[model samples]
Structures are given as C-alpha cells and as structure tokens.
Target: MGTAILSGIISSQGSGSGTQEIDLLPTRFIACVRRPESEDAIRSKLPREAPDSTVSVYVKDNCAAAREADVILLACQPHLYKPLLLESGICTALKGKPIISVLAGVTSNEITHQLCQTAKTESKGVYDTDAFSVIRAMPNIASAVQASSTVLEIHPRPQLKGVIATAHAIFSCVGTVFTTKPGNFAACTTLNGSTPAFFAMVIDGLVDGAVALGLSHTEATQMAAATMRGTADLIMSGKSTLDLRYEVACPGGATIQGLQVLEEARTRAVWMRAMAAATSGQSSLKEGLKMSRGGF
Candidate 1:
C-alpha cells in the first residue's frame, strides 16, 4: 500500500504536468513498517525522491510506527488485518490517531470492535475504543501511476470532519476521490478496486481484435488505450455515453457494426452481472471476517 500510494503521489508531483501539490500529505517524515524479511524489498520499491523528508521503516514493529505517526494506514491483506490489529498492540498505539484501512471487506465497526477487545484485554488507558476514528478506503492499483479512482467511507462524527480533508488530500495525490456512505462501501470497492482490472480486459480484447485485423499488437494496444482515455475524457466533458456512441456511430458505419456485435453478445448485461456478483459476494466476505476473527 505504501509503495502503491506513495508511487502515485511521487508521480503526480514529480512528473504530472500542471498537477497541484497535496498540502495535507506530510512533507516532514513518514514511518513505514513491514515484516523484517520484506524491509529491503519494500525500500527498493519506494520512490528515490519522495516528497517526504524521511521515510523510516520499522520491521515487525507496527506499534512503534503507529505511535510515531499521526495518521496510520492499515494496508495489510484482508486476512492479516485481524491478527495485526489484535496481536501487535498497534490498535492501542493508534489511540486517538486517524486509522485509515485499505483492507478489502473489513468494515470500520469491525476495526473498532477489535480495538475495544484489545483494550479490554490489555487494561490500557491508551485507547478510547468507544470513539475510534477509523476510515475505510478503496483505491485501485492504478494509484501506482497517479490514475486511480478512490472511494472513502468514514463513520459520521464531528472528529472525523477534519480527518476527511486529510484523507481526501492524501488520496487526491494519487487520483480523484469520492466519498461514499458505509452502506455503499462494498459497491464502491467493486467499482474502484475491481473495475480497472475488468477494463484492462476490455482494452486487451480490443487490442486482440485489432491485431486480428492485421495491426501490430503494440500499435493496436496503444490506439485502444488512447481511445479509452479519450472516450472517458469526452464523457466527463459533458457528453453522455449514449450521445458519444451516437456521435461516433454514423447510420451504418464500422463503429455501429462493432456496437451491434457487442449488443448481440449482451455486453452491457455481462458487465451488470459482473458488478452484481461482486456486490453479492460482500456478504459472504463479511461473514468470513466474523468467523476468522482470531487470526488470518
């Protein structure tokens, strides 16, 4: 997560023309933690010239890192989140700090519950579990290149108002940000996290068809990619998808022929079904999270 988000920030600020600097992103220092064995590999993945003055890595010392940082990102795998939160004392260390989770399917309530459990066991006054400030976020892998679409959800609280700005600022460095209610988080995950992979497949399929028509694979892929980008830009510029399709597909042109093929294959239905499947699967994932609370 550090590599992904940090790479995007570095790209947006370092190379993206006309991109504005994210003021909420820390410029002074960053504390990153990873497994001891992964320290070198993770460090190698970091940007050579990150905007932050220092990025200190703590191996297998999540609590130390949490204690040192004002904002803590729990970006571990979904399965590992429970263990990391419960076993590491990191939740206790988080205390009143902002904890943003990028773990898929793990809700903010689950995080708060685990923190309260940890506090009860530890008998520590370090954490105020009843008023945990947790945020759930879904940002795509495209963040590595400063093109992700991120969705965030924070349980409404007065304390979280300012936290949203910080969250928005941090994510905006990578790409556009959208705020969603907790009820819509799973749907947002399918949109932001899964849609990019699905669109990549669409792009590749277009490239394959182009190659079949005698275009070089590289040439076809570049054209298809550029077309997708331009189409999105057009849509954002106030042209509806249907209007754009109508504009491109003349009465009996090649574009209309291609669209007819897609229509015959029920392409729109297929996409809708895919999204429905992902959204439906969230319930099972939530159940699994509950059953696997003790460990990964």
Candidate 2:
C-alpha cells in the first residue's frame, strides 16, 4: 500500500502532455524497510521530480526517519506496532507529529496507547504534552495507477486541521478520497481494501468466459476492463445500479439472459458473503488487539 502511494504520487506529478505538476511533488520522501537489500526496491519508485525532490530509504532505522519527517506514515505490519515504538527515541521523536497509519484494523488510539507505553513521562500518568496527531487511512494497491478508493477516518481534532488537509492532499493524488466517521472505519476498511481484488476477479472471470466464446484472451481482457471502468464511471455519475442493469437488459436480450444465470446462482449474495468473511474474524477489539500482537 505504501509503495503504491509512492508510485501514484510520482506518477501524479507529471502529465502525459509533458507539463510538470509541482504541487503534487513533495520536497522529499523517506521510505524505511527492514533490510538494506530492500532499499533498491524503494529506490525503484523515485518520484518523477527527483531533482526537485529527494527520496531517502532507510534500513531498520525508522527512528531516524521519524526524526526527519514532518509527517510520518506507519506502514509496518499491524503486529509490529509494539516493536516499532520500542525503538529508542522513536516515541519521543514522534510526539505531537502528524502521523498517517495504513495498518488495517489498528486505530489511532491504539497507536497512541503504544507510544505512551514507551514514552512514560516524569510527570504523573501523562506525556506532559499532546498525543501524536494521527490519521487512520485504508488505501489499496490500485493507488499505483491513481485509481485507488481511499478512506480517511474523521474524528474531532480541531488542532489537526492542517494535518488533515495534508493527509487529504497526499491521498487524493492516488485516487478518490472519502472521509467517514471513525465509528464507520472498520466497515469502510472492509470495503476499501479487498473490493479491488474482487473487482479484478470479476474481470478475470469475464475474460475467461469471453475466451471460451471465441475471443482472444488479451483482447477479451482489454474489453472487459474497459467495460468495468465505464460502468464504474456511470455509477459514480449517479446512475443507479438497478437502472443501469435493467437499462442494458432489454426484453429478450442477451444481457438479461446472462443476468438470469447470475441471479439463479445468487452471485450478488455470494459477493456480500465474501465481503462479510473478509472481516468476520475481527468482530471485537480484543481480537484486533490479539492480532496486533503478532505481525512484522
């Protein structure tokens, strides 16, 4: 997800017509990984405005990255959060900084709790200062192509307005950005991440069916993908799903016959079940906390 956002930001900084879009290009980007060998992978994603911007990749040195960054992104695996803050000086360096975390199922409060655990203050039970200004986001791999459907958790943080706008600008470069109440975050996360993969699966099946019906695989794939994009555009433009479906399903039409086949098999219900299963195990905060104790 982090890599996709980097690629998207890089791609968004330029236009096909050769004009540079400077506003989308940040002055620097820092990416941290677990190994020095991983540095090249990040280097491969350098921004289009490289000379105008600098990218520094770190190996197992997130503390250094945190110290230098005005905005911090926590892209580590969910379970690694505990250890991430365990790095000496990390929690202190991050105090009151704007943080954007893409870890699924981890909340801003959970992250703040972890940081407080590490940076126990000399004063009574508090940090003697404000907690990290954190933003929770759920974005997908499609961000690489600038078509990601990203969600940002919205909570009352009157002082974090500037940070919120920064978060929005960064994400909007990757795709459409939607802000929803934090209470709806988990449901939105379920819809944000896996839907793209599910959409791809639908396109894949259509391509195979097209192949079986005599179209070349490559050509069928292109047509199916284009149709999917067009359909999404129509829906986004306020066309109701039922209206679009019925509009294309004329009386005695092939489209309606195909729709009947899907209806008989309960395809829509199956899709709903798949989505439900995605987060079914994450039914409680206890479960999420347990999972948080286990990743990278």
Q: For each candidate, how many residue pairs have backbone atoms clashing (under 3 Å)?
A: 0, 1
Q: Model 2 segments beyond 4 Å from truth?
A: 16-25, 45-53, 121-125, 281-296
lDDT of 2 by residue, 96-138 (tens): 7888888777788888877787777422366632577888888
Scanning candidate 2 in windows of ten residues, the lowest lDDT window is 16-25
Candidate 1 wrong stretches, greater than 4 Å: 13-23, 28-34, 51-53, 124-128, 283-296
**Residue pairs in clash, model 1:** none
lDDT per residue, candidate 1, 24-69, as tens digits? 6764435455556565665576677663355666777777777778
